[model samples]
Target: MKIQLQTLYNEYLNIKWKRGLSPVHTEPFEYGLYEDDSADLFLSGHSEATFTNWMSELRPEDPYYGSKPNGMPVLADIFNQLDVYDELVLYYLLFTLNTTMSIHTHNSYSEMNDWMKNYSFFQLAQLNGLSSLNDEQKGELRDFFFFFYLYTHPVNEETLYACSFREQDLIHTKTNIKLEHYFSAFHDHYSENRDKYGEQFLIAPHEIQACEQLTLELLRIIEGKSPKLSMPSEEGLEAVVDLINNVEQMLQMYAKNRTLVFDVMRNFLADPRTGLYRNHCFTMLLQNYASYILYFNFDEIHALVNDFRDTPAWCGIIINKIFTDAIFIHKIMRKNAIDIREYPNVIEFFDEQAREFCL
Candidate 1:
């Protein structure tokens, strides 16, 4: 992917060079009061003239100011030297900064506005002639920018520490098996069948019964109705038990207090510094997963999921992972139990799954 991205970037640069439109250096100017506030405000109105003015305003005394050349020509030249992944990281960092600044500025002044309708990073990129990216590259870029935004924003870090039990819900929904049972069965099935089957397996009656018995024992341990399993540590029984307990706790919390779920989620999702843009955008995405436990608008859940999955952000990465995992687990279950036929190897299975499930 990095190699492909580099090739695409080179092609883009070649197009620019052939047109004799390489970025040029200009004299610096004073940017006035815009420097005191969000840089997005200045950048939104950016022209070669504005960029020059903004660069001129940089002061030696400013703690954040570095000695790197601030002109576009110099910056473009620097970009040419970076590896594709490094270039993406640098571009996404800038994107997050601008997005954060823009969201903060919008929230301060517009008490009731739909910023999503007004703002878009994709549009901004296209306007700047940055349209060389393929869908996969765009997804990676969104994920990178989102994580950058999430970690940098000022919120109680603890709010972000919740166990993501959505994966369990996904497994249950897709496979029609409880998560505990699924994991136990999957572990046993993988151990016994992996080498023999080479990605194709048939379920014997004994294997099914053994899996059921193991699942029951796991449930007993998780429920505190029995002592810990005596299995070898390599089997990861302890880790499975821990996961079950954490997910159980999360479910209990959701069942006991719906408002608490929203409140904690709001702390993570509602912050303007994270660039969710609109209140509804946050509410919509939260509703997709939260609505399974809480009573909220259900009509838009699929649309919301699609929206989040399409957007290039941390939320999208998360949604994609959750659904992708569910699909993978479902495939595994089908292969081991029901299919009873030779299937595509694991790599092919994943490639097919990615095409079906991922953005």
Candidate 2:
């Protein structure tokens, strides 16, 4: 199993990513990950630009080569293409919070930094397919993290320097946790940083604690230990569950009444447990919801436009293209000397949202 896992990791390292799609140490905006056309380009599966093509290339031996029915691969199904350990590690590297930052700061660096820093393992487990892994696979994941932390060169400080700060902290903390203390230097470095920054910059304190608890829980489950005393670690797990539930509720409500989405947004943003503000993954999902809702629910324009003001400023900014559509419509109506009142929905929505351009 170890040999096979090593071979898979080697193959993964050898696999090349599409330009601009590769793992980047720089901010998402600086690298164009959040460009207006990114989602469209990704959904369209153009050449090597989309994840679908990337995964298809990964599993060339398969008959279908990882193509899904929609031609766009879902996050969960992406894991099914790889060995359990491979998925676990790669997912962590790709999505987990990394402390590395560009020395050159972008204007919205703090905003994007919050997103990057708070994209923790708990969220990844829910967003990725780890939550759906079978018991055997779960055991393998647990054992992989355990043995890999101890026996592997991950503990070497020199090697860790190349890793993101979050991964390095996890290794050091795990070593001390196992009472091995093999990486005291790393632990001391983590301590100094935590003191300076209030916690490890790479991984939040709660998340680090959660990861430890999760591993212990997995060990107990593998050993047939059924129920145990309640621990604070479960809070992190519950946070992920709450996030998934809130997203589902928001999406369902959005389909019925676009206006109701504002209420959902208020509740989600106000509730600290959802962590939507800090989490890049969830914030992007909300922005996506707003994007489509704006175009498809123009009939509910008055309510939608009015309620959107109550959402975070960033929400409106992220979907600024919707405002562009309003501008185009208003211009056309004015050019024909059309009575804007005849189009009450558009006029009212435009007046409320883009009042400066209203004729």
Which TM-score value belongs to model 1? Answer: 0.20
Q: Positional deviation of 105 in candidate 2, in angstroms?
A: 11
Which residue runs of candidate 2 sit more than 4 Å off their true CA positions?
Answer: 1-107, 117-123, 128-245, 266-285, 288-359
Report clashes for each candidate as comma-separated counts.
Answer: 1, 0
Worst 10 residues of 2 by lDDT: 95-104
Residue 145 of model 2, lDDT score = 29
The collision pairs in model 2 are none
RMSD of 2: 20.3
- The segments of candidate 1 whose C-alpha lies over 4 angstroms from its true place after superposition are 1-85, 103-253, 257-359
Instruction: Compose the digit string of candidate 2's lDDT tens values, residues 182-265.
Output: 122222333344445442144433333333332333323222232321111123333333433344444456567755655544
